[model samples]
Target: MSKDNAPATLPPVKRRNAELVMLGVALAVTVSAFGASGLALDGSLPVGMFGYGIGFIAITIGTHVALRFIAPYADPLILPLAVFLTGLGLAMVWRLNQGDGDHAGAGMQLIWAAVGMLLCLGVLFFLKEPRVLQRYPYLFALAAIVLMMLPILPVIGIERFGARRWIGFGGFTLQPSEFAKIALVLFLSAYLVLKRDVLSLASRQIKVFGFRVFDVPRLRDMAPMVVAWMLAIMLLVVSTDLGTSLLMFGTFLAMIYVATQRSSWVIIGVSMFLGGATIAYFLFSHVQLRVMIWLNTFDPEIADNEGWQLVQGLYAMAEGGLLGTGLGAGRPDQNFAADSDLILVSFGEELGLAGLMVIVMAIFLLVERGLRVALASREMFVKLLATGLSFIFAFQVFVVLGGVTRLIPLTGMTTPLMSAGGSSIMASWIMIGLLLRLSDNARKPAPQAIQDEGATQVISR
Candidate 1:
C-alpha cells in the first residue's frame, strides 16, 4: 500500500459481521415476541398478537431510525436488542393491564418510549463529539446535583412507598435521579481525563513493616469524588433511595478505576463505601427496615406485609417454570406493585424463565459489545464514556435483578428499557445514544494520521 490506495480499502468482513449480528437480533426478538404473545393468549394468537406485533415493529423502526441519525456506524446489534427488551416490557405491561384496567402506567410507558426516542435523536444531533461535553463538566455536575435534590424540595416532591424520590409536574412525575446518573457520568469522565496524570502521580508514602502505604489524596484531587460520595449517601439516607445511591457510587468507583488503572483504588473505594453504608444503615430508619425485610422475607410473620413483594415475585418466577405459564394466564397482575419495579417478575410469571433468560442474554450481549467498543476506541474520553455507560447498564441490571430475587435488599430501581417510567426510559436512550456515538467514532479512521498521509501524497503528486 500506497497512501492513496488506503482510503479505498473496504472493511468487508467487519461490515458483514455487523449485518449478520443485526439480522440475528431481529430474528430472535421477533421470535421472542411471538412466543410471549402465543403463551399469554393461551395459543389462541388473537388478542395479544396484534399488540406484540405493533409494539415490536414500532420500537424497532423507531430505534433504528433514531440510531441512524445519531450513531450510524455503531454496532447495529444494540438498537435491536434495546427494541427487543422494550417489546418484552410492553408485552408484560399489557398482560398486567389486562387485569387492572385502571392502571395507565403501560400506556404512559409507550408514550415515554416515543419521547425517549426523540431525546436520543436530539442527543445525536447536538452532541456530535464527546469532546464537546468537556466544556460543560461543572455545569453538568451542578445540574445533576440539583436534579438529584429536586425531589426533596418542598411541595413538589412526592414521597411514595417510604422514599421521597419523585418530582410531580402537572399530571406526570419524573425521577430526577435517573437523569442525574448520566450527568454525573459525564462529569466524572471529563474530570478524570483532565486529572488522570496528577492523580496517578505518586505522593507521599508511609512504610509499615516493609509495606508502603500512600498518604491520603490531596484535597483538590479528592474533591469531586468526595462530593459525589456525599450526594450518594444523602440520597440513600435522606431520600430513602438506596438503589440509585449504590448505582451512583458504583459508577463513580468504576470511573476512578478506569482513570487510574489501579486496583488499590478499588480496595479503597470498597472500604469507604462499606463504612458509609454501615453508618447509614444504623442511622436511617428506612435503611434498617429494608435490611430487616431482606433478612426476614421468608419468615412467616412478615411474609404477608414487608416480604409480600419478594415472596410474590419468587412465586411468579417459579410458576413461570422453564417456558412460563403462558403470558396472561399468570396471576401476577393480582399482586400489588407488579407493574413498575417488579416488572421482571411479571415477565417471568407470564413469559416463563426462558423468556426472562432471553432478555438477560440480550442485555449481556449489549454490554459485551459496548466493552468491545471501549477497547477499540483510541481516545481516552471515548474509552471512559463507553466504560461508564457499560457500568450503568450492568449496575442497573444487578440492582433490579437482586431486588426481585432477594439476593440483596430491595432498592426499588426500575429495570432499564423495560421499566414503565419516563425518566428511566429517557435516560436509558440517552446513554445508548452516547455509546453509539463512541462506537461510531471508534470505527472511523484517525484524523491526524489520515490527514498527514493525504498531505504527503499531495506533495509527491
Candidate 2:
C-alpha cells in the first residue's frame, strides 16, 4: 500500500504510568501521616515507620506492576485510592497500638493487608473470565448461606459485643459474613441477569378506571426477592447483625433495580426490610437498644449504656473541631472498636473534618469508577456484577460512617480498607480485584474483525 493509504497509528495509552504516579503520591501521604503521628505521640519517630513505608510501597508498586501485566486498561485511580485508605488505616492502627503497649494489632493488620493484595492478585490471575461466575449462581448463593450460618454453629460460633457473627477456629476468629457479601453479590448478579426480562415485562398491570396505576411482578417472579427477605430476616434474628442483614438485602435490591429497571421491586424490598426490622425491634432487646441509642444518643441513661460508643465518637469529633488534634494527638484508644467500626470517626477526631472529607472523597471516587465500568461493559452479566459490587461497597461505607456519625443506628460494619479486621480487608481487596478485572474488560479495545471465505469472525476470547 502507498504511504498515504497506510493505516494510521494511535498513541499508546499511559494508564499504567498514571497509576504509578498516583501510587507514589499515595505512598508519600501515608509516610507523612506515619511520621506526623509518631512525632505527636512519642516526641520521636516510631521505630517501625521506615519498615511500614517500605512494606507499603512494595505492596502497592507490586500490585501496580501486576495490573500492567494483566489488566493494563483497568481504571488507574482505584488502586491508588484504596492504597491511600489502607495506609491511613495503618497509621491510625499503629498509633492506637501505642496506647496498648503492643504491636500485635498493627503487625497483624500489615500481614492481612499483604494477604489481601495476594488474594487480589489471585483473582486477576485465575479469573480469566468473569462470566464463569454466572454458571454457578446457585452454588454461590449456597456458599453465602453457609458462610453466614457458620457463626451460628454450636462448636465454633462466638458472640462478641452481643453479635454472633464470628466463628472461632483454634486461635483466630473469622467473620464469614464479610466474604459472604461478595458471594451473594455474585449470585444475585448472575441470577438477575437471567430473570430481568421476565421480572420487568411479565408483571401484572394494576389498572383503575381503565388507567394503569402500577405493575406487580407475578408471585413466581418474586421468588428471589422473597428468598432474600427471608434470609435477611433470619440473619437478623440469629446473628443480630443489622449491618450485614441490611447490606446483603440492600445489595440484592439494588441489583434487582439495575437488572429490571423497575421501581416496584425497590419499593417491595424496602417495605419488607422495614417491616422485618420493626418486628425485630419489638421482639429483640438488642434491636430495641440500637434504635433507642440512635434516637436518644445523648440521653444520660442510654449514653452510659448502649449509646456510649456513639457518644464518645461524637465528643471526639467535636473536640477535634475542623482541623482535628493532628494525627496521633487524639485519644482514639479510649473508644471501643475505634480501629474497626469507628475508624472513620477516629480519623475525623485526629484529621478533623477536612481530612475526613478527603478520605470520603477518595472512597467516592473509587465507587464512581466502579459504576463507570458498569456503564462501559457490553455484557448484561458483567454490567450487573459491577453495579452490585459498587453499590455494596458504597453502601457499606455509608452504613459504617453513618453509624459513627449518628446519622443512623450503630451497626457492626467495618469501613472497608480502613478497618482492622482480616476478613474485611481480604474481602474488600477481592472486590477490588473483581472491579479491576471488569473494568479491564470494559475499557480494553475490541478485537478487529476478520473476513473469512464467506463469513466474518470476531475474536474476543
Candidate 3:
C-alpha cells in the first residue's frame, strides 16, 4: 500500500504514551518527596525505589491495557485519574508507614497493586463482552452473598479491631466485602436491566392533598432491595462493619433509582433506611456506641475510648490547617488506626486541605466521567453498569469521608485506593477497568445492524 493508504493506527499508541508521561511525572514527584523526607529506608536505595516506582508504573499501565479490552471505548481521563489516585494513596501510605514503624503494608500494597493489575488485565482479556455477565446474575448474586457472609461464618470468621470482617488464609487476610461489592454491582445491573420496564410500571397510588403517592411495591418487585437491605444489615449487625454496610445500601439505592427513575423509590428507600437504622441503633449495642461516640467526639468523658480515633483524626486535620504539615512530618502515628480508616485524616494532616481537595476533586472527576459514560451508552446493560460503578465510587467516598469527619457515625470503611488494604486496591482497579470498557463502548459508533435492531425493539416494546 502507498504511504497515504497505510493504516492510521497511531492514535491509541499516542494516547497511551500521554498517559504514561503523566504517570511518570507523578511518580517522579512522589519519589523525590520520599527521598527528601529523611525517612528510614527499608532496603537499599536502588531496590526500594525501583520496587515501589516500578510497581506503580506497572499498575497504571496494566490498568490502561485492561481498559482496552474490557471497556475499550471509555473516557481517556478515567485511567489517568485512577493512576493519580492510586499513586497518591501509595505516597500517603508510604509516608504513614515511615512514622508508624510498619514498612510492610506499603511494600505489600505495592505487591498487591501489581497483582491487582494482573487481575484487571485477566478480566479484560477474558470477559470481552458485557453481555456475557448477564447470563449469571443469580449465580453471581449468590456467590457475592456468600463471599460477603464469609467473614462472619462461625469458626472461620476472624475478628479484628472489634469487628468480625476478615477471612484469614495462611498468614494473610482477605476482606470478602470488597469482592462482594463488585459482584453485587454486576448482579444488580443485570437484574435491573432485565426488570427495568416492569419496575417502571406503577402498580397503585395513594391520593393525599391532591398528590398521588405510590403504594408499596409488590413483594416480587421489592425482592432485590429487600435482600440487599438484609445483607447490608447483616453486615452491620453481625460483622459490625457499618461502613461497608452503609456504603452497599447507598449504592444499591442509587442503582435502583437510576434503573427505574422513580422518585417514589427514593422516598421509600430513604424512609426504610432511616427506619431500619433507628431500629438497629436501639437493637444493636455497637450501633448505639458508634452514634454516641460520633455525638461526643470532643467530650472528654468518651474521648479516651470510643471517641479516640475520631478525636485524633480531627486533631490531625485541624493541625494541618490549610497547607498541611508536609508529607512526612505529621502526627498520624499517634493513633493505631491511622493507617486504615483514618488514613484520609492523615493525608489531610500532612498534605493539608489543599491536598485533600485535590484528591477529592480527582475522585469527583472520575465519577463524573463515569456518569457521562453511562449517559452516552447506547445499551441498557452498559448504562446500568456504568452508573452502578459510578455509584460505588461516589458512595464509598461519601461513607469514608463522612466517617472520618464525623458527618455520620464512624463505620470503619477504608477509603478506596487511598486506604492501606489489599482488597480495596484490587477492587478499585477492577472497577476502573470495567468503567473504561463501558466508556469505550459508549464512544464507539453503533453498527448499523445494532441500530436497526434497537429501533425495532423500541417500536415493538
Candidate 4:
C-alpha cells in the first residue's frame, strides 16, 4: 500500500487503427457473401464478384483515410457497421437481379454507394462545427418543406404505386423526403434547444380535487408542435405517403421528448397521431386498404389480390425457418419490393432468423453508439441533434420491420443502408458523417492548461 506503487495514468488511445482492421473484416464478409451467392446460383463464382470487391475495398480504404484526417477520434464501429449493412443490401439486389436478367439495378446501387461515400466525406470536410447548423433553424425548416413538396410538383414529380413521392431527373428518380428527414431533424434540434427550458418548466397544470392532473403548454408555446402535426397531416393528405408522414412527425416527437424530458409531450404527440391516423383512415381509401391488409392478410378475399405481397413474404420467412435456404436458394423476388421496402423479408428468406438477427443487431449497435455520443456531448444542440438523428434511424427501421411482420399497417419506408434506394443511401451516410463529427468533438481530449512563469507573483509578509 505504498503511494509509489499506485498505477500511473494511462494515455488516451484513439483507435483509428482498430477501425481500419474492422473495415477489412467487414469487406471480407461482404465479398464472401457475394462469392457464396454467386456459386450457389451459377455453379461458379460471379463474374462481377472481383470487380465488386475491388471497388468496395477502394471506397472503404478511401473513407477510412479521410476519417483519419478529418475525425481521428470518432467512434470506430460506425463505418464498419454501415458498410456491412450496405454490402448485404447490394448482394441481395444483385441476387434479385439474376432472376430478371437485368444487372442495371445492382450496377446503379454500386454507383450510388460510391456517390454516398463522397457526400459523406464532403460533410466531414466542410462542416467544421456541427453547432454552426443550429443558427439556421428557419432555413432548414424551409428547405425541408421545399424538399417534401418537390415530388408533388407538376413538371418533375412522378407517381408510382399510388404514392406521389418521387421526382424524376433524367431517367432516374429521387425521393426528396429522405433528405427532408435530415433537414427537419436539424430544424427540430435547433428549435427545441432554444425552447426546451420553457417547454419543460413553464407548463400550466389542470387540477382535479386538489391533485394536479396534466400539464399543458401555452397555446403560443405549442405553435411548433402544432405546425409539425399539421405538416404531417398535409403529407398524408397530399402525397398519401404514410411512411414519410409518420417518420417526420415521429422524429419531431422524439426530439421534443429528448429536449424537454417530459412524458406529457409524448402522450400528447401520440394522441395527436392517433387522431390524425383515424381521420385519414376514414377519408383515404389507401389508408383503409393498408389497415385491411394488415388485419386480414390471410383472408381469401384479399389474400390473392391486395394482400398477396404480405402473404408471400410471410410464407417465404416461414419456409426459411431457422437456418434459411442459403443465400441464392430462396424465392424472395416473388414478393413485391423484394429489394427495397421488403428487404428484411428478402434477407430473412435467405439468411434465416439468425442472419436477420445479425442485421437487426448491427442497426441496434449503431443507434446505441449514436446515443452514447449524444450523452458525451457538451453542447445542448449537439446532444439533441445526435439524439434526434439516432431516434429517427431507429424509428425508421422499426416502421419497416413492423410492417413486414404485420405488427402494423404497411408504411412502405425503406430500411436505412439496406434498401436499393439512392436517397436512402445518401441520407444514411450524411447522418453517419454528422455522428462522426459530433463523436470527434465529444471524445477529443480537452486542451491542457498552460502555466506562465512570468505571471506568478511572490507574496511578502
Among these predictions, the greatest TM-score belongs to: 4
Q: Write the per-residue lDDT of candidate 3 for residues 141-181, one digit (tens) a residue.
A: 89888888898877678998778878987887889988899
Which pairs clash inside model 4?
A: none
Better of 1 and 3 by TM-score: 3
Taking the tens digit of each residue's C-alpha lDDT, what string does model 2 give over 142-184?
9999999999999999999989999998799999999999999
Q: What TM-score, computed on C-alpha atoms, does each candidate reach? A: 0.87, 0.93, 0.88, 0.94
Q: Lowest summed lDDT over 10 consecutive residues: which window, candidate 4?
A: 449-458
Alpha-carbon lDDT, every model: 0.77, 0.88, 0.78, 0.88
Please give the lDDT score at residue 69 for candidate 3. 52
Q: Could you tell me the lDDT of residue 211 within candidate 3?
A: 88
Model 4 lDDT tens row, 1-461: 58897547443456999998989888988899899889889889999999888998899899999999998889998899989888888889988888667788888888899899999889989998999999999999999999999999999998888788999988988999999999999998898888888888645787899898667776677778888899999898888888899899999988888888777787888899889989989998888888899999999988999998888888988888988999988888777999999999998999999999999999989999999999989999999999988988899998898888898888779999889989999999899889988888888766551122123322321
Ranking by lDDT: 2, 4, 3, 1
Clashes of each: 3, 0, 8, 0
lDDT at 273, model 1? 76
Give the C-alpha miss distance for residue 317 in model 4, angstroms: 1.2
Off by over 4 Å in 3: 1-14, 39-47, 62-73, 206-208, 212-220, 446-461
lDDT of 4 at 113: 90
Instruction: Judging by lDDT, tell me the better candidate of 2 and 3.
Output: 2
